[model samples]
Structures are given as C-alpha cells and as structure tokens.
Target: MFPENKKQLKLIYFNMKKIVAYILLVFIIPIASKAQNVSPLYKDSIQLQWVNEKYDSMTLEEKVGQLFIVAAYSNRDASHENDILKLIEQENIGGLIFMQDQAVHQIDLTNKYQTASKIPLLIGMDAEWGLAMRLKDVERFPWNMTLGALKNDELVYEVGKQIGVQANRMGVQFNFSPSVDVNVNPNNPIIGNRSFGSNPDRVAAKGIAYMNGMKAQNVLSSAKHFPGHGNTDQDSHKTLPLVPDNKADLEKYHVAPFKKMIDAGVQSIMVAHLNIPALEPDPKIPSTLSKRIITDYLKGELQFKGIIITDALNMDGVAKMYPPGDVDYRAFVAGNDILLFSQNVKVGKQKIIDAINKGEISEERLEESVKKILMAKYITGLNDLKFLDSKNIFEDLNSDVNKALTTTIFEKSSTIVKNDNKVLPIKKLKQKIAFVPLEQTDYDQFLTHLQKYTNVELVNVKNPSEINLLKDYDAIIVGAFLSNESVYKPYKLSDNSKAIINVLPQDKKTIFSLFTSPYGLKDLDLAKFDAVTVHYQNTKEAQVAAAQTIFGAIGVDATLPVEINANLKEGKGIATKHIKRLGFSAPENVGLGKKNF
Candidate 1:
C-alpha cells in the first residue's frame, strides 16, 4: 500500500458504454457527425458538467473502484490497518462511511486512512438527527416524536445544517438524514421518532427545509427507506416487511416527501430493505434489490440523476432477506449505484466479477454507475477539501450552534391539549392544590419537577378496599409521567391509580393529567374524572405547556394524533383527520411539543 498523503491512482473512470457510443460516432465522422466532446471526469470536475473531457483520460480499474464503497474504521493504531489498507489498495474503494463505533478514536484517523488510499475518500454517516444519535461521547438532541410537535420548520433545517457542520468537521461528506418517514403507526418500533410526523405533507415540508439547511452547508442529503417505511407492522431489520398498499396510498403518504426532496435536488436516495407488494412481487426481495421499483419509479418517473445507495448490507434486513450469492450483485442489477457495507467485500467482489464474466450483469451498467460515483467525487470538491484539518476540531466539532438549534426545536413543539375549567397557569391549582404524585420510585425527576409547582400527597392505595386516603384536598391533580405506551394500549387502568381517584371525596374536585401519550386516559375511567387533559410528551416543556393551557395562559387545542378512547364508538378516539391530512395540528396549548430529552 502506498501510505503517502492524499494518494493518487493511475486508473480510468468513465462510462464504458457511453465511451463506445462516442467511439462509434467518431468512426462515422466522414461527414463530421460529432461535436468536439470531453471526458466525464473532465466534465464533472469543472462547473459540475455531466459530459466533460476527462473521462477519456482515466483507466478501466479506476472506473470499477469508484463504484464500490468499503466499510472502514478511523482507529490510529494498527487495528484499522489491514481492512483499511487492503480495500484502499486492492479495491481502490471510492469512499467510507463511519459508524458510531468507528469514530471513537480521535479525528487524526482521517489523515492516516486517506493517505493509505489512492483516492480522496467521500465519507458519510447515518447521522439522521445529529452526530449524537450514533456516535458515543456526543450529546443527543430530542428524538423526532418530540420534534414533530414543534411548528418551526426552520429549526428542523438548522438541525440538519448543524449536523452537517459536525460531520464535515470529522471528514464526512454526506449525512444520511432527515428520515422522511411519516410515523402513522404508533406501534411502529423502529421509525417512530425517526419520522418527522404522521402527515406526509408536513414531512415533505420538513424534509425540504432540512435539505435546504444541509445544502446551505454543502452536505449531500439522502432521503431514505424509499417508498416509505412508516406504516408497516414489521421491522425490516428482523425480516422483510411487506407494506401492502395501493399506488394512491403510496403517492399520497409515503412518496410525498421523497418526491418533494427529489424535486429539491437531493444528492442521493438510500433504498431500504422493505417489501412493498404493489411495487414488486418478490416476497423476499427488498426494494434495495428490486429493478422494477428502483429503475422504473425512482429513475424513470422521478428523474433523479444523482447516485443511489443501499443501506448497510450487513443490516439484518438485507442479511435475512438475501441469499448467500452476494445480494449486492442483485442490488447492482436492480440499479443501485453504490454497494454500501457489504458484509464480506471479498465475496461481494467475487460475485460481481463472476456476474461480469458470465455476462449476466453487463459491463455497461457497471461503467454507468462508476461514472456516477466519480461524478459525485468530482462535484463534491473532494479533491479540493482538506479532509484532515485537525487544528481546532475538538472545539469546533459540537459548536454552540447545535445546542441553540436543539433548544429552538424543543421550544416550538410543546403543546397543550385541553383545559375544561381554566385551571392552568397554577393560579387555580396553587390556590387550592393537592399534587398526588403518581407514587413511583423510578421517576424521581418527574415527580421532583412536579414538586416545584404544588404541594404533594403521595397517594398510595394499599389495596382496592383501602380507598379513603385521597379525600382531604379541595382539588386533586394526579401526576403520572412515567407510563409507557405498551402499558396503555390494551388499556389497563392501574388498580392503584384508579384506587386513588376512587377514594377522592365524591363532592371534591379532581382531574387527571397524563404526561406520556394521552392513551393513558383510556386506562382511567374518563367519565369518572371531572376534567381530563392529555399531554402526549412528558418533557418539561410538555409539562409547562400542559400547565399553561390548564389555566388559560396558553390556548389549549392540540388534536390528539392517536386514539384515546374505547368509549364513544367502536373506533372512538381515532383521529380521522390524521389518516389523510397533509399535516394535522397537534393537541397544542403552549409550545409543549417542542422540547426533547
């Protein structure tokens, strides 16, 4: 391996098929049938041209190397030596994507890794929200669900720009982010907060805003899990999830944000390991390996001319869904431009080589993708960027801009659901208050915050039979912040929770303030409680929002996105507007939905 800095390679990078076309056109130049043309590399390098003069100057191996992206580590020690050097030298891989685990070492690792390679690497990460999401030793902003309540699209965009800043500081070129999934299913385990919200148009607006923010900082944004991974009941990481929906549903909900971002000039699209029956029939074949969807819908119809990358092939979604014959080869055939994180590169390389030898995957397709890969490198100014600038990276990595950006988002999202009798702003509660802390040890901070507002009565119902412990106060407010969603869905009214409410004097006034999802309201007897307010998130902002709304200090009208009842009708508390609204208003009072933990 040539371990010199910014290593240069003597290899070709061009679309062999396009080159052949030009050649045949050249041979027919008896009457001068062609314009003076340039190479793809030359075209891409200067002024971001597609048909330039330098493609003709590169070698065959350079083009092949550009099509592959190898998984690499940034460790300075020899721990990263073998795989990093082998791929960079033998494979001439075009780029690297850092995992949270891969970036634990210092930033100096970039110089060593880049020097070992023959080409300047374009680095990327799955830093959806920020660097803190994946990498350890970094701060995490609020998750996406809390963010959805915030109405400030600009804040969301700023988050992207800040993520780009940190990533770029660490030598990353792309941020695989702004997960455009519209989270309609609350039971969706993987993509809940990862999504912007439950509305497609809202997600689209946020996606465009975030993309613009990323573009402001020159980071290529990728809209991922194409089609949409929000409504499915299964986790792709475990098995291929088949999202059965008609074209109308897809266009209306799932494809809305993708179309918006593609129009906004997103640089790449990362395919997910999902099985949409309407798009392709292969029960086991994910969209990452589906030609019908990737080529027909994404390329032809959408007209996206940039690169297409698959999510890590090592993910169980691809591993369990694919067979042993190097599914990446199938992915290439299906129109993916980069084979990201293939579990075994040797196997992947051999399979692709065998396919080329057998002529099953034409060399023309390979060359086309290689040209795209090179074009990305050339246009990103990878050759111009100083990837190893370590002078003040530690101080600049997580700049103050990120903390402010996160704070902005949290501020806008806090919302207030309902205030039946204008008891919020603490004037009403504090005047004649009895804070019945939902007596649970696991949530000390939640109760500790509850204590700041009112006097507490740790109401513990010894048994259902012992119920009069809650009778003395003029008004009762229950503080139940530690409840989880699963604990409420099948809906069990906590015997103790109901017991406390049960013992309250028949003439005394009482209310239930659910701090998690309003679904907890279903667990309690809603009819029995005099006034009920549901604040979906329990963040301090949510609490404050709920508090303000309860007293008319903030207007309380945020519509609940999920069902909060088994009462009125068969499908009672389900919000009908959420199913089809482009963007729905949350049960907002103050900006409670905006804060993140």
Candidate 2:
C-alpha cells in the first residue's frame, strides 16, 4: 500500500514537467517561425466549408463575377471611383488590383470598395519590391536582381516577410509577384532587374523564399509570367515576345524555376503572354490563351493544383490579338481561374454567362473557379475582415524595423567584382584620394560617407577637357551613377562618360563603383580599373554601404547574379576581408553619448 502512494507521486512529477514543456513550446513556435511556409488554403476544411456555404448562396451572375479581378487606382478622382463602383454594383466583379497611389489613399479606397461589394473584395498589387513599387515615399526593398546576388536566401525571406507584413497591414490579399523567370538574356527589356538572376537554380531558391515569406503572413503569392518571361528581347507590354528555346532547353533554363515553384507548393501562377512554338504549336496564340499550354501542360503535365491567373489582359501582348470579351472567354476556357485586369468586366461577364447558357462552358466549370476564389478570400481572412485604422498606418509602414532591414539588404548585396593587387579596403589612409562623379544624379551621400573614414577631395569632371584636373590625386574613386534604374531607361553609360572612364590616367590607381544594374558593365572594359564594386542602386543606403565596404567597415560577399560578359560571368565576386576600421560600439565609446545628434 505504501508502494502505490510512492508510484502516484512520481507520475505527478512527470506530468508537471510535461506541462511546463508544452507551455514553452507554445510561446517559442511563433518566434522561430520566420522561415516557415504557410500550408495551402484549399487544404483547410474550415475554409473549404466557408467556400462551399458562400458558393451555395451565389447566383450564376455572382459566380461569374468572382472570376474577374479589375484594375483600380487611388490616384484617380471621383470619376474613377464611380466607374469602379458601377462595375462592383452592376457586374459584381470579385476583386481590385490597386496600381499607382499613396499608401493611405490605397487603404481608404480598399475599405470603400470592400464595403460597396456584396461579396468581400480581394485586393491585390504588383508589389514585388513592397508597396513602394506602386506607392510614393514608402519603404522599399531592393529589386530581384540585387536580391539574387545575396548568398543568404534567408535575407531574401526576411525581405519578403517585411513586404508581406507591410502589405497585410494595408489589407492587401494578393501580391502578384516573385516573377520566377530565369533571365538568361542580357538584353531582356522587361525582366532585366525584375528577375532574380540568370541561373535557374538561384531564381528558384529566391522565388521559393519570397513565396513562403508572403504565405507566412497569409498573403497569397502568384509566381508570374509562367512558363517564363525571361530570355525575351522585347517587352511583352509592347508585343508578344518569342522564346525560341526548344522544349528541353526551355525546361533546363527558363521553365526550371517555375517547376520548382510549383513543386514547392506555390499558391498560384500567372501565365505570361509569351509565344513559344516548342510548347504551343500555334505561333499566333500566346501562352495566356492556349489550352495546350495552360490546361494540358501547366495543369496536367506539371500537376499544379493551385489557382492559374492570367497576366494583365490589357497588355499589348494579348490585348491586340482579340477584342475584350472574346479574349476573356478564351482565357477562361484555357483554364485560368482569375482573369486579371479584364479590359471590360461587363462584356466579359456577359460573354461567360452566354457560354454557360449555351453549354459551351459548364456550370461546374464556373463553380470550380468561383469556389476557389471564395476559398482564397476566406483564407486571406476576408470572412472577418476589419476596416484598417489609418491613424498610424503611414508611420507603421515606414517603421525603424523596415528601414533597418532595407539597410541590411543593401549591405549584404553589395559585390566587389575586381580587386587587383589587394588594392581594396583603401588601406593607405595617408594617400590622397579624389572622388569623381560620373553620374547625372547627386553623389553627396557617397562623398560625405567617404569623408567619414579619410580625407577625400571632390572632383567634378563632365567632359574630357576637365579630366586633366584629376591628375593630382594618388587614387581616383569614380562613382558611375544611374539616375533612372527603370528597365526601359538606358543602363549603358553615355559615349562621353565611357570616353572619360576609358581615358582615365593609367598612372593613378583608379577604382570604379557602379550604382546601377550589372548589365551596364557590358560595354565598358572593366580591366582598366584596379578595383570595381557593384552596388546595384544609387539610393542613400546603397551609397553609404558602398562607402563602408570601400573603407573596410563591411566586407563583400554578394556574387554577380547575371553574366555581364564571358570573363565577368555569373557568380563572380571578390570576397574582401574586413579591416574593422569603423567597428561597432556604444555611442559614448565613440565620444558621442547624446540622444540627439
């Protein structure tokens, strides 16, 4: 009898320890979930039930409306609002993709649109680099090309997570991003900086991280321009770009990333308006409207079960091919779940209705897409949707955390391509250094930051006649800045700029820093420069990071994401050891203890 009491006491102690462990587990899980990916929405029973219940209550016209995601803009006046409202009221469109607008304004319009619609509207944006891509004066992450150079995909995940956090705060449901295109072509007018890199493996790894990061915040992501938008010389917005690669080569290079994305359980894929004869037999038909490409291949062959969305139907790649209603019908028949940026919602909805009525398209087909859209809405938390409290949204979106993360990304992505004779880190502080601006934009931040480490003289020479003035310095640091980093803009240096760089004095050690895409390095002979660095962007943070790296405050780790030429191929980077001249310390330790600078 005494033995029984002792055994019971031992069991109680074990149970107490288990309870403590359980409590710790609950608290620690979310903290360690930064790298975790969210499960697919369609797999959840509760969301499916909500979808079924909502689908049962919908009329045929309402079901048809769920397929259309129309374009919306906050930059417009009451006329635009009234126009969008009319479509919501009359056509019952399912969603809105906000284009260009300020952060607060977009939130306000989102609230107004959601209230006006009978069904809670799904809001989407082309925020590949966060809302800063569309909105002004907001927090911005680096482009995909910059991110591709990063050795740590975790940093890319963090970038995606931050973008997701900001997007969720603004009530955006979908981020039509992570263009999983492999940029094999240097002259790709559209996907130059938008793509991760030339390597399919690198693109896939980065795309997976980005997709998972957004998923963690319950924001749906679409790996876009599927089949792949990279390797095309022309912009799809202008015309249908041709991808001449055979099936095996296409699979090896362009389509590889998309396959990886799908395998990684990407929630959706946006079909590109590309013409690939290897995949689609008809050259006239773009992938967006091809049954063989979308239904047979992407859906059947790839076994992708997620939502298939079309690229903006208004783009010239598909828009010029057919009229509004006809093109929308073909896209639906081709098996896209969402028709994005439909040219005319009214005509498209009516066309689908007519097709359903005539038995050309079954009611079951309509139900499939409508139910899927409803499931997405429920999964994105639209069922318990709360109107955003805009009082501190601007401040929240541009928080210290956002700025710090962006600065960190800039630091990590800076790459040194050439450092001959161990000339980097500018070890000789006693040597006279001249800061030359080979840019149309301002280089004040770069110059100012350079002065923090050592004495530097500013040299402004716009033409060859003024170049003689630079002969006095022991070393010349040239900042080749690109003001407009747009893909449509010129990335190559001007003839005059090239002439000045090429003719720089051979006697003086010349170190060149490019503040633009690595593709700009194509024409210039990089051999002349004793040391070279590619910072990718001309932003203040990038400028500061470049300066720090030059002075050995930070070491270089990022590699070239794309090939500039045969010699400067992909994955080329010079890893420089840190000098620790500007090391981390407390403010007081550095002789500045005041709270305000």
Candidate 1 runs further than 4 Å off: 1-58, 73-81, 102-106, 321-325, 353-364, 389-398, 436-467, 482-597
Residue range 1-597, candidate 1, lDDT tens digits: 653443333222235567777876776442232221222122212433432333454455555566667666553357565677777778777777776453435356566667776667777777776776556556556555555555566777777778777777777777887788876665676776577667777777778887788777777778877889988878877777777778889878898889888877777888888888888887777888889999988888877667788877877777876653377777888899888876665566677777787888787887778766666666556656574566765456655555555544443454434334543434533545555655333444434444555565555545556555655667766666653322122223467767766665656566666666443565565544566665544555455544443344344333333333445211112111111212112323223343421
* Most TM-score-accurate candidate: 2
Cα lDDT tens digits for candidate 2, 1-597? 333687898988899999988876886455334212333446455666788888889889998999999999989899999999998988889999999977788888888988999999989999998888888778678889989999999988988888889889989999999988988888888888888999999999999999989888989999988999887899889899999999999999988899999889888899999999999989999999999999999988987777889999999999999999788988999999999999888888888899999999999888877877887898789999899877898788886666766777788898999999978988899989998888666787889889998899998888887889988889999999887445355677888888888778889888999988999899898877999999887778888889988989888799999988988999999998788777432344345545336
Whole-structure CA lDDT of model 1:
0.63
Q: What is the C-alpha RMSD of each candidate to the true structure, in Å?
A: 11.5, 5.2
Q: Candidate 2: worst 10 consecutive residues by lDDT?
A: 31-40
CA lDDT of each prediction against the hidden true structure: 0.63, 0.86
